[model samples]
Target: MLDKLRREFTLITFGLSGVVLLIALVMTFVSNVTMQNNVTLSLLNRGLEVGHALNPQMGSKDREGTVGADSMLTVSVDVTPSGIVLNKSESPVGLDEDALDEIVAKAVSGSETSGTNWARHLAWAKKSTVYGLRIAICDTYSRDVSLIRQGISGVIIFLMSLCALYAVSRALANRSIKPVSEAWDAQRRFISDASHELKTPLAVILANVQILQRSKDMSAEDMRWVGRTADEAEHMKGLVEDLLTLARADEAKAGSVGAAGPMVELDLSEIVDECALEFDAVAFERGCTISCETEPEVMVTGDKQQLERVMNTLVDNATKYAAKDSEVKLSARRDGKKAHVTVNNKGAVIDAEDLAHLFDRFYRTDKARSREETGGFGLGLAIAKSIVDAHGGKIWATSDAASGTTFHVTL
Candidate 1:
């Protein structure tokens, strides 16, 4: 349970951190791109303001002075409405007539006042001036290179940050769960200690009740009261035993009790068949029947007694809840390295929500039903689950109206 808590904490923290970091990185990249485009467009507009007659080489003193180094790569052209280029600016970069014409045609026909020609690594702006139409185009090679470097660096940093966050989150999760872990351990120990302490007194009570029942002087009404005491004592004893079993199971899971029991290769098929036979009379008394379909020599390595208990618990649970005149099916089969056991019964369908907690200790779907009627404190399935878990197997149940309810065990 502590392990599960730690895992969930780490995942949730790391996932949220990763998302925030990703969003920050994306926003930074987009902001940089937008800023770069705005600067390029501003340079284009400035280039158009300074006509070709005012050459920077001539050191023309104008309102905007000589164009900056970035604007030096700009190409400005004045074109008539009839697609005639009347004036053009000199550019350091070579541009053939065909390429220049293409750039001019695209800029003049563009829907937007300003846009970029990505294939040519060019940013352009168009405007209607006193001299027909003015088109300004600027090279964006430097901007593209800067953005590319930024993107690669951002990705590398994002990945590194995630790795570091994962390590830190795991550390935090462990530290955060320490108190809960201590409390859980304390509870388990208390249950183990309390149950151990109660066993002797319960045994003595039952023994005394048996002795009193044999007394010859007891009246009929007094005997009835003694019998009731014995019955209640027995029920209390059963509950204590169940709690003790759960405590031991918890210890086994934590490796504090070493191995729960001896594990040996045993025939699961035989266990299933035997369990079905043992529950035959109980099922018959309930107007239900036990049916077994076990494959021969289905072998698995586990504690034989614990495995038998699992089978008995499943079969007994099925028989108790099975509809009148219905069959409780117990089956075992070998599938490669795994042995499969299933107990199915035709009964009222268990709700999806209740199915999830069926193996939880003292969890009963029929809350209003008397424990006397079920002859259980709802610990049977929990014990079965603990045993299966100790054996490194899986146990779960599925229910539906058409197929009724089925408990599946995979070992």
Candidate 2:
């Protein structure tokens, strides 16, 4: 149980951390891409403006409008029909001869003439002229790409930080479950000790009441009081035993199941059938019937007496709660590698909210309260859960207006 709780804690911590960090990383990358696109588009627009400023047909106003919009150096070259360059204008920082040759060759050959060089942070663009010629333009934008590179670096660092946080989160998750695990262990120990301490007093009280009832000197009224004391002491004894059983189950080691010598291989199908038959008579007295459907040879490794108690408790509860003249069904079958037992009664539907606490210790639902004559201490299901846990199994309940209530167990 402690291991299961620890695993749950680890998953919750790491799962939340991963989801939150991933979202932050995605937002950061998205914003970074947006900013980079804006910067790149600005560089391309500046190159286009420079190209338009040197356009042959541009009026003076167009040139004036283009001025001061972009201060990046640019060169415009026209490639003629014979693939010879007609240099139109050169910026103060003119393109190197090799670079000019590369751009002219691409434009004249009708290939893509717009791109950037990583080594120099230069951007280039080209446009075709009317007489089978082309004008190519190039410029430098080192500062803009440099800023983008730094922004990308920051994103990388952010991603690395998330990794570190994930690692730390796992460590914290381990530590976070420690106090809860320790407190739970302490609770189990306390219950075990208290139950053990109460057993002797309860036994002594019951023995004394039995002695008082047997004495010829006692009147009928005195005998009645002794009987009541005996009955109440027995009831308290059962409660103490239940608490001790649960404490023992909880104290089972993390992975060393079946370590206790008391458990043996049990025929689950036989137990269910016997409980159903036993309860059939009880149900018949209450104007109800028990119908059993058990698969042959269904088996589990568990304490037979404890498992029998679980089945008996479930059958008794079902028989008690089933509506008059309604049917209570008990079933046992092998489901995959596990044994499944189900007890279903046609009766009052348990509320959705009550179903959640149905197995909780001392929890009586509103419907259970209505049948006070057949009152229970409300620890039967809880004891069954502890036994199921000891056997490495699961138990749950479901209900609805149409189907009544069903208690299901897997072993």
Candidate 3:
């Protein structure tokens, strides 16, 4: 239980932190891309403004003062609408004539006033001027490289931050759950101690009541009172025994009581068959029948006595609640490495809300039903679930009007 709590805490914390970090990284990337586009377009516009005087042979110093040092790599062209280059400026990097023609052709044919040709690492803008169609192209290789580096760095940082958050969240979860863990331990200890303390007195009371009922001189009225006392004592004893079983299950789950019992390979099919036979008479008394269908040699590894208890509890419960003249079915099968057992009965459908909490301690679907009517304190399913969990298996139930109620166990 504590492990589950810790895992949930870590996941929620790490997940929320990851989302926030991802958003920040994405926003930063977008802002940088927007800023780079604006700067590139501004350089292209400046080059078009000075189209008439953009001499191909102009020195770097002269052009630097005119359109900034970064704009030295810009290519300005004066082209006609029919795709003829009228005049062009020299590229500092010495781009060939074919490349320059392709750049001019793409810029002139573009529908937008400004756009980027990402394949060639260039940004271009065109405007109709008195000279001709003026087109400006700027190198975007350096800007693209910067953005790529930023993206890689952001990904690395996000991953590293998630790792760090996992550690921090785990530590915080441990600290947060410390008090609750202590309280839970205390509760389990109380139940174990109280149940142990009650057992002897309950036994003494029952023994004395049995002796009183056997007295020869006792009147019928007094004998009736003694029988009532014995019945009530018996009921209390059953409750105490259930509380002790739960306490032991709790201790086993917490790993404080060592192993629940010795685990060994056992034939699950035989156990199912045995439980069906044991409950045959009980089901008959309730006007229900027991049916068993088990695959031969179906096996699992678990404590034999505990597994028997689980099967007995399930079969008994089914026999009690099954509709009159209906069948209580018990089946066992092996599927690869896992074994499956199911106890199904035709009876009134358990509501969805009640089905979900069926394994919770002391949870009954019919709250108005007395313990005498139900013949249980509602801990049988919870005990079965605990045993299954200890064996690293699963147990659950499903109910509907047509199918009635079915309890399933996979080991």
Candidate 4:
């Protein structure tokens, strides 16, 4: 249960954190692009300033002075349509005639536009008049590229922070569930203690009723009353025993802390067959029938008594609620590395919501009907689940209008 809590907390926290991180990443990318566009336009405008100086008809001169523009530009080469270098700007490091011709060929053959090649540390912008020479501005987008690198580093930092946050959330989740785990353990211990205290009195009462039943001279009315008392006592005994089973199962699950019982190999097929036969008479009395299709010698490792209780609980539950004149079937089969046992009964379909909680302790679908007609505390399936869990197995129930209700066990 603590592990389950930890996993649930981790999933929920990480899911929310993922959304937040995604939003942060998106916002960072948008802001980076905005910054890049602003800076690129600034650089391109500077190039346009220098080009306008050469051709007064191109556009109006820039309001921002070109004082520091030359330092930023390595070479502003002018090339003709036939790829002749007409002019080259004054710079400390200038492009060779070969490089200028190559760039001019590509620019003239391609669309007239501004572009940046961060890989080769170059930026180029072109302006052309119809049937005239093409003047191009070329430089490096060092500032814009630096901004992009910063964005990349921010993304890496976000991922690392997310991982660190996840680790912290898990640690907090463990601490948060510790009190709940303690309270749950205490509740189980109390139930086991209370059930033990009640057992002696229940046994004494049952023994006295049996003694009274043996009196030959008793009147019919007295006998009936004694029979009723015995019946009630037996019912109480069953409930107390179930509570004890659950308590011990808890202990067993808590690191095998001196469990009340141990598991051993048992023929599951034989167990199912015997249980079906044992309940056949009861089913007949209730206008129901029992049918079993058990695979012989199908074995499992489990406690014989607890497994028998599981069978008894399932069969008795089926006999009580199964539609009159309908049949209940028990079957055992081997499925891969495990064994499967199923009990099916024809009955009204259970609602999906109620079906989900059918195995929860004290959660009955029809409380009044179960109390008056079925006479159970709604712990049968819960006990069965605990037993199966202890045996490293699983148990669940499913129902539908077409197939009736079925309880399946995998061991």
* Higher-ranked by TM-score: 2 or 4: 4
Q: Which has the better TM-score: candidate 3, or candidate 4?
A: 3
Provide the lDDT at 20 for model 4: 87
Instruction: List the candidates ranked by TM-score, beginning with the highest.
Output: 3, 1, 4, 2
**lDDT: which is higher, 3 or 4?**
3
Q: Stretches of candidate 3 above 4 Å error?
A: 55-66, 91-94, 130-132
lDDT of 3 by residue, 40-59 (tens): 88878878876645544544
Model 2 residue 76 distance off true place after TM-score fit, in angstroms? 5.7
Misplaced by over 4 Å in model 4 are 52-64, 67-77, 81-85, 88-112, 116-123, 130-152, 216-219, 256-260, 294-299
What residue pairs are clashing in model 3? none
Per-residue C-alpha lDDT of model 1 across residues 248-303, encoded as one tens digit per residue: 99998777883348889899999999898898999999999999999999999999
For TM-score, the strongest prediction is: 3
**lDDT (10s digit) by residue, model 2, range 272-297:** 98888777778999889999999999
Question: Which of 1 and 2 is ahead in lDDT?
Answer: 1
Say which candidate scores most in lDDT: 1
- TM-scores for all predictions: 0.86, 0.73, 0.93, 0.82
Candidate 1 Cα errors over 4 Å, as ranges: 54-60, 63-66, 77-88, 93-120, 126-135, 210-224, 334-338
Please, what's the RMSD in Å of model 3? Answer: 2.5
By lDDT, is 1 or 3 better?
Answer: 1
Alpha carbon lDDT of each predicted model: 0.88, 0.74, 0.87, 0.79
Q: How many residue pairs collide in each prediction?
A: 0, 0, 0, 0
lDDT of 1: 0.88
Whole-model alpha-carbon lDDT for candidate 2:
0.74
